[model samples]
Target: MRDTQRTILVFGATGQQGGAVARALLRAQWAVRALVRDPAAPKSIALREAGVELVRGSFADIDVLRAAMKDAYGVFSVVPSSPSGAVTDEEEVRFGTAIADLASESGIAHLVYSSGASVGEKPTGVARFDTKARIEAHIRELPVTATIVRPVIFMEMLVRPGFGLDKGRFTFFLRPNQSMQLIAVDDIGKFVTAIFADKMRFSGETLKIASDTVTGRELETILTEAAGRPIAYARFPDEVLAANPYLRQLAASLDEGPLADHVDLNVMRELNPEILSFRSWLAGSGRKALDEALGTTGLGL
Candidate 1:
């Protein structure tokens, strides 16, 4: 189908993944439609300025979803999980499966669902990670042509205000030499745009995507170089992990291998050569955030 005749409906447009997808889709000359909770919000307004049509509604509204899906060639689905506390795990599953069902019923040619990389051949029993696994199973059972993109831990999350950056140190999931895969958020858009542009090749496939991998020691070196200051690196203290169930689960997952990323860098480069490494990201789009993070000290990861 011609780009002019095609529209891709995107959820979470006001947030990271959806925003990236919308921006990339527009740059590629495809009509982009976003389902938003507030059309008057700054992000939504920016989307409008950039030529995205906005449909104001929530996932709970069936009529809103139907209207947004009308005449849309593809649907890029990424829903908020337990982190937002905007919904429970059951609610997350309900919304996710519902979107797939809606897309199928709407006759969408392609449906691309973004899920977490931690999901594996079996459920990890982590609420956040397992939630996507459930969603993936539901999408697979649907009659619609679908693609599942499992993204690793976001590179952006590494440089957030907390996590000891202000104290001239960094604490994360991996040991000093244990590598973890990470992806730049914008690259997610690049990948999805390619998938939408070539539906036949991507449909029915589940892809694990990561731009780069780095160990904790590597993160220390990279951050120090980027910040032009000394920044030590260490794994989360056992005491801290033991106290926080969430952090403890994540740390355990890393140790056990389920949370560890196994994406092939060479193949991902072929798919998206513009993908940024951790240092390149800190040098580029991440510069401002890193600068801000280094200037403040917040608690927790």
Candidate 2:
């Protein structure tokens, strides 16, 4: 059983990763407190309704962050990166390091930082991922009990509209025979919940998590079975890669190995037995997204 008296300070509670973690912590019976820019926003209100204590503020507000961390047993840190153009790489490093420094200074018991799979000892040269690497490095040096989780590509991204699901085809970075790992967003919560549950085993560890590993051909089979129609799977053509520098760089990363197969599924399953594979995700929480991508349903989840 969890200690209901112990609270967790979760950052980015209204966003995808933070929202998932906050909900999972609540489900596990841990008291959750979140800092949000607008407490009246629909997502923020929903979080409050679900029992998360809301603190009105942004990442730039140091006093608010310090106040929220007060008396919290643990902190879950995730910051926005340059990909969204919301914050620059420098700002991301600052926010991440600031959270760690504050958590350490506040005497928080444990700190869990969510990073990208591509981030590692050496820089990947991708500013977004390298930025996470910098943050991870900074956290390791802090006087804090920190655990870093590097999640692979999200299964949800595969079903998004531009991926060609609407045209009865799937276009991604993997070649037909090449394989990559993927994790459902919900499963991220499950893993983090387990981490928070067993700090002794997970603390000071950097875990790479994924629910399943599949090749392009396997994806086609799974999508075809789920959609009840043939969904051709193909890698982004050279012409498309040439036209988009960002896509080209991502594809190069996949081919060169940072974004390729690396997770140990057996270990991940041991941490969270309910982890969802691509097929299982499509049949459950991922269904509506897939339907919308396939043009079988209207927008707005």
Candidate 3:
């Protein structure tokens, strides 16, 4: 938690979680060392311009990871989850465990891992995100002072095509009367910064991080207000889930429990002042994506 230490080595600096961590650390006046696959990439270049020591690296290469983390104060860890098809469940566990091992061996001070909301101390049946569960377990078994943050579904994902946003409707994992947790990605960084600043309280703690809960009915009202048009909300059709086994299983998991009405949003905004509700984010940071999702016609949600 000491800000005067070497630096915070951030993996996936080009992606959402790591980018948030890097920016927050910089604002806290901590030295930032970011690992990226291509430091020359525009985003990586931008990080460099912002005073981060961008190290060209990939998660698969341990030497690069080691080189980046050498003598660092802490490490912000997040795996590229498999929902995108770029990684398998097995690959995600491998990267997560490997990083924890490396962090332990290198004497990294504090390790904050970005895990998924669906993951808990006990196992859920979903393979797509349960990988985070496995990794969280692995981290706890290690000797490092680590904090695990399990984030709920992103509010930004609401507008994806598969959600039925393109058809003046919204279809999602939640039922019509159910409430589900959601968070803005920008809030992830601020929450993490606060965690890093007070390691004594947060160290070795597992957190289920979310900002708000919305029922399908509430989502309909909010989206309609934002778009200045009617946007009806409905649960995913049985046939649609039947056609897509992964989504069907995912929906079934939510129907079962844990996915809906799981976190306390009132306590969240108290912990972190930047927790933005869906309505506020739409009028603010989410405006561009809201516009695009409103106009989008096809592809995955």
Candidate 4:
């Protein structure tokens, strides 16, 4: 059981990953405090209603961050990255490192930093990933008990507009038989909650988390079954790859094995018994998003 008196300062609580962690922590009976840029935002208000203490501030608000950490038992740190144009890669490194530094200084018992699965000891030449690598390095050097969670690509990303779900076709970085690991966003919270529950076990550990691995063909079959219609799946055409350097680079990384076959599903299931598979997610929390992506009200799958 968690200590009821213990509070966790959660960054990015209004965002996807942070919101998942915050909700899971609260459900586990851990007091959660969130830092939000706008306390009046609907998400923030919802979080407050859910019993999370809200601290109004951005990542740049050091004074606010410090105040939020005071007397907190743990910290769950995640930051916006350059790809979203929310912050530059340099700013990402600074915010991540600053949070680690503050957690250490505040004598916070545990810190969990969310990073990308693509980030590793050597830079991947990807700004977003390399920025996290720098932060992980900084956290390791700090006098703090910290866990680094590198989550693979989120299942949510596959449903985004450009993925062609609406067109009854899907294009991605993988070939038909090639596989990539994916995690439901909610599973990230489950894993984090488990980690926090056993700080001694996870301390100083870098865990790569993913709920399921599927081939591109598997994605087509799943979507077809869910949508009640065929959805073709294919890798981005060579011409498309040639035109999009970013997409091409991501594909190259996958081929190089950095983003595939790294996670241990058995271990993930051990840590989070209820961890969601792609099919399970599509049937539950991901159902609505899938419907929206398909531009349908419901397929009744």
The models' CA-based lDDT, in order, is 0.89, 0.89, 0.82, 0.91
What ranges in model 4 sit over 4 Å off?
A: 1-4, 298-301
Model 4 scores a TM of 0.96
Where is model 1 poorest over a 10-residue stretch in terms of lDDT? 292-301
Residue lDDT tens for model 4, 95-210: 99999999999999999999988886677776887899999999999999999999998999988878898999989988999888999999999999999999999999999999
Return the lDDT, model 3, position 42: 97
Off by over 4 Å in 1: 296-301
What candidate 3 gets wrong by more than 4 Å, as runs, is 1-6, 296-301
Looking at model 3, report the run of 10 residues with the lowest lDDT sum.
Answer: 292-301
The TM-scores of all predictions, comma-separated, are: 0.95, 0.95, 0.92, 0.96
Tens digits of per-residue lDDT, candidate 3, 83-143, equal 7777888999999999999999999889999987766446666786678888988899999
Over 1-301, each residue of candidate 2 has an lDDT whose tens digit, in order, gives: 5565699999988988999999999999999999999999999999999999999998899998999999999999999998888899999999999999999999999999999887756766668888899999999999899999999889988888899888989998788998888999889888998999999998899998899999999999999999988999999889999887667766776787577647788888899988888999999999998999999885432
In candidate 4, list every pair of residues with a backbone clash: none
lDDT of 1 by residue, 1-301 (tens): 3365699999999999999999889988999999989989899899999999999999999888998899999999999997898989988999999999999999999999999877888867678888999999999999999999998889999988788888899988678988888999999999999999899999899998888988889999999998778999998889988887777777776777566647789999887879999999988998878887888324222
lDDT of 2: 0.89
lDDT winner: 4
